[model samples]
Target: MPDLITPTTRLYRAWLDAHAEWGPGTHEDGFGLTSTDDVGSRAGFASWVRRLGDESARTTCRWIIEDRQVLGGIALRHHLDEYVRWAGHVGFGVRPSARGRGLAGWALGRMLDHARLLGIEQLLLVCAADNMASATTIQRQGGVLEGIRDTPLGPARRYWITLTPPIG
Candidate 1:
């Protein structure tokens, strides 16, 4: 079974293995990684992890792990900024090898619970226009289409998921 976990340096080797599988670049969404983040060295990785912890007030980052391996990641930003406006409140990615297992939607559902705890009544999720898989996942979670908008990365499909109060 896959478990959603907070970022920790204790899983350094496991994370490196997963990062290696991703090849290169900061395309690993949901990880809060940046082009300038140096995750190659031990100190660097630890620092990066610490920075994520420091941002816990504004963002929640979690990794999907099964059998001690990192399968993917998901992040929920608590507020809207310019980047959040384009990228939406949530960002996520499943490693190439872990595609097709419904991990994205599963993780997303958990994150929606988190959003509710934070009093976020609604969420905005945007995916590339060509990414049918992501679009489907969002829709499955009750996402309603809000149309597409052009972004620096290209045309993106925007969706909104309204949260209802938890049933007693």
Candidate 2:
């Protein structure tokens, strides 16, 4: 694990390159990593990541890197608020160019490994009802559909991943 997550990390820079600088009429970038200037510099990101999972802290985020390159990222949120209740525990994104290669599923499995370490028993993952890709990824990670809920963001489906103990 990284001692700290920073914008200076190759993963952060690669993520910024993957989804930064949106044009008109485009969908809002989902990763929320677009803030890369002085107003949202690497230093600030370091600070933000340092506080994740503190007492009652909402979330903890991490990048998926292999062979010194960032393939994607995953976040495990502790609980829900009015803003996040529908979304549940896990959220993730892979680079657009890296899609369709099963990286998201692999990355999610890796996230599950860490989630178990975090004492997460029943992990909830949510994606937009229309996001079949994410839904499939979650399903492959042993997710079972719990229900769907309407939210300010839209309709979202939540799946639960029950963490099982490793074979001794």
TM-score per candidate, in order? 0.97, 0.72
State the lDDT of candidate 2 residue by residue for 1-168, as single tens digits: 222232234355654455454322223222333333222467654554444324224566666655555556666676556545565777787766667988778767876886777677888788889999999999999999988877667998889899976545
Taking the tens digit of each residue's C-alpha lDDT, what string does model 1 give over 30-138? 8999988899999999999999999999999999999988999999999978888999999999998999999999999999999998989989999999999999999
Per-candidate Cα lDDT values, in order, are 0.94, 0.63
Predicted structure 2: lDDT: 0.63
Residue 57 Cα positional deviation in candidate 1, in Å, after optimal superposition: 0.4
Give the clashing residue pairs of candidate 2, or none: none
Cα RMSD for candidates in order: 0.9, 4.6
TM-score of predicted structure 1: 0.97
Off by over 4 Å in 2: 1-12, 21-58, 66-69, 79-84
Candidate 1 lDDT trough over 10 residues, lowest sum: 159-168
